[model samples]
Target: MESVITGLILLLVLLVFISEIYKIRFERKNESQDERGQFLIFKVKSLSYTILSAGIFIGFALVAILKVMKPEIFIYYMIIVYLFQSVASSIYLSIVRKI
Candidate 1:
C-alpha cells in the first residue's frame, strides 16, 4: 500500500511537471529573438557544454572509484545525467531570456 501510494504521488508529480513544460513551450512557440537573444543563446550553449564535460568527467571518476564495470549501468547513468543537464539548461535559458 505504501509503495502504491508513493507511486501515485510520483506519477502526479510527473504529470504536473510535464504539463508545465508543455505550457512553457506552447507560450514560447511564437516568440522571436534579437541580437541580445543571440548572445544569450551563445552564452547558454557555452555554459551547458562546460557543464556537460565536467559531468562526464565526474561520472567517469565515480565509476572508477566504485569499480562499477557494468557497461549498461554506466550508459544509463550517462543518459540520465545528460538529460538532466539538458533540461536544467533549457529551463535556465528560458527564464533568463524572458527576463
Candidate 2:
C-alpha cells in the first residue's frame, strides 16, 4: 500500500517535470541561439542526463536486491546511492559541456 502510494506520487512529480521542460523549451525556441547550437547543446545535455538516469535505475535495482535480504538498511542504502549518483551526474554534465 505504501509503495503504491509512493509510486503514484513519483509519477505525478515526473509528469510535472516533463511538462515544465516542454514549456521552457517552447518558450526559448525562438529567443534562444540558432537551431544548430540549440540542438548540439541539448544533445550533449541529454547524454549526461541519460547517464545519470541509468545510475538512478541501478540504484533502484540495488535497493530491490537488498530489500530481500536486509530490509532495515534499504532506505539508508538508497539515499547514499542516490546522493552519489546526483554528484556524479553534475560532474558528468560539466564534462559533457567541455566536450
Candidate 3:
C-alpha cells in the first residue's frame, strides 16, 4: 500500500515536471504575453488562493474545535496544501492552454 502511494506520488511529480516544461515553452512563444495570458495567471493564482484560504479555515476550525495536540501537525498540513496548490494550478494552467 505504501509502495502504491509512493508510485502515485512519483507519477504526479513527473507529470508536473512535464507540464512546467510545456508551460515554459508556451510562454517562450509569447503565447501568454498578452491580456489572456495575464488572465490565465490571475485565474491560477485565484484558484491557489482559494485552496490556501480553505486550508487556513480548516486548520483554524480543527484547532478551535478539536484543540489539536502538539500543534505541529499544522505544519505538515500546510506543506501538503501548498504543494497541492502548486501542482494543481500548474496542471490547470497547462490544461487551459491546450483547450
Candidate 4:
C-alpha cells in the first residue's frame, strides 16, 4: 500500500511537472513584444542551466567518490538542484527586471 501511494504521488508530481513545462513552452512561443523582458528571460534561463549543470556534475562526483549507489539519493539531489535553479532564476529575474 505504501508503495502504491508513493507511486501515485510520483505520478501526480510528474503530471504537474509536465504541465508546467507545457505552459512555459506555450508562453515562450507567444513571447511579449518587450525585448528587454525577453532578454532577461534568456539570461535567467542561461544562468539557471549553468548552475544546474555544475551542481549535477558536483553531485555525480561526490556520489562516485563516496561510493553511494542509491538511486533515491540521486533523485533527491536532482530535486534540490532543480528547486535551487528555479528559485535562483526567479530572484535574478526579479532583480534584473527592476533595473
Candidate 5:
C-alpha cells in the first residue's frame, strides 16, 4: 500500500516534469540551438536506455538466481532505476550543455 502511494506520488511528479519539458521544447526560446538540444535529448535517451537495460538485466538475474521473491523488491528496484536514470540524464545534459 505504501509502495503504491509512493509510486502514485512519483508518477504525478514525473508527469509535471514531462509537461514542463514539453513546454520548453515547443516554446522556441532556443530556436537557434535546436541541434544542441536535439543532441542532448538523443544522448540522454541513449544513456537512459542503456541504464534501463542493465538494470532490468540485473533485476532479472537477482530473481532468477538469488531467489528474490518479494514483489516489493522489484517495485523498489524499478523506482531506484528510474531515479538513477533521471539523475544520470540530468548530469549528462548539464555537462554537455556546459561544453
Candidate 6:
C-alpha cells in the first residue's frame, strides 16, 4: 500500500513538472512581447533544474548512507532524505534570488 501511494505521488510530481515545463515552453512563442517575463521565467526554470539535479545527487548520497547504516526503516529514511534535499534546494534558490 505504501509503495503504491509513493508511486502515485511520484507520478503526480512528474506530471506537474512536465506540465509546468510545457506551459513555459508554449509561452515562449510570444517572446518579443514579454521579454522581461520570459527572462524571469527562464531563470526560474533553470533554477528548478538545478534544484532537481541537486536532489538527485542527494538521493544517491542517501542510498550510500543507507547501505552503510542499514537502518530498519530504510524507506522512511529515504523519503525523509528526499524531503530534506527538496527543502535544501528551495532554500538555496530563495537565497540566490535575495542576493
RMSD of each: 5.0, 8.2, 2.9, 5.2, 4.5, 7.0
Q: Please give the distance, in angstroms, between residue 22's alpha carbon in candidate 2 and its true position after superposition.
A: 24
- lDDT per model, in order? 0.66, 0.55, 0.76, 0.70, 0.70, 0.55
Error of 3 at 98 (Å): 2.7
Instruction: Please write out the lDDT profile of model 1 over residues 1-99, one tens digit for every residue.
Output: 999967865665565476457435634554425667567667667767887898788778777876655645788667656655655666667687689
How would the candidate models be sorted by TM-score, starting from the highest?
A: 3, 5, 4, 1, 6, 2
- Residue 45 CA error for candidate 4 (Å)? 0.6
The per-residue C-alpha lDDT of model 3 at residue 91 equals: 78
lDDT, model 6, position 93: 37
lDDT of 6 by residue, 33-61 (tens): 38654554566567666765665565556
Clashing pairs in 6: none
Q: Residue 93 of candidate 3: its Cα lDDT?
A: 88
lDDT for position 40 in model 1:
65
Residues 44-94 of candidate 4: C-alpha lDDT, one tens digit per residue = 789889999998887887677766646568887787677667666666665
lDDT of 5 by residue, 1-99 (tens): 999988976885675476446435533557325986767778867988999899888887787777765656887787677666766666666576678
**lDDT for each residue of candidate 3 in 1-99, tens digit (9 for 90 to 100):** 999978976776676677567667666776678988878878887988999899878887777677873477787667667667777878788788777
Stretches of candidate 1 off by over 4 Å are: 1-32, 65-71
Off by over 4 Å in 2: 1-68
Show where candidate 4 strays beyond 4 Å: 1-32, 66-71
Model 1 lDDT, residue 33, Cα: 55
Q: Which stretches of candidate 5 lie over 4 Å from their true place?
A: 1-33, 68-71
TM-score of 1: 0.60
Question: Could you give me the TM-score of model 2 versus the true structure?
Answer: 0.39
- Candidate 5: pairs in clash: none
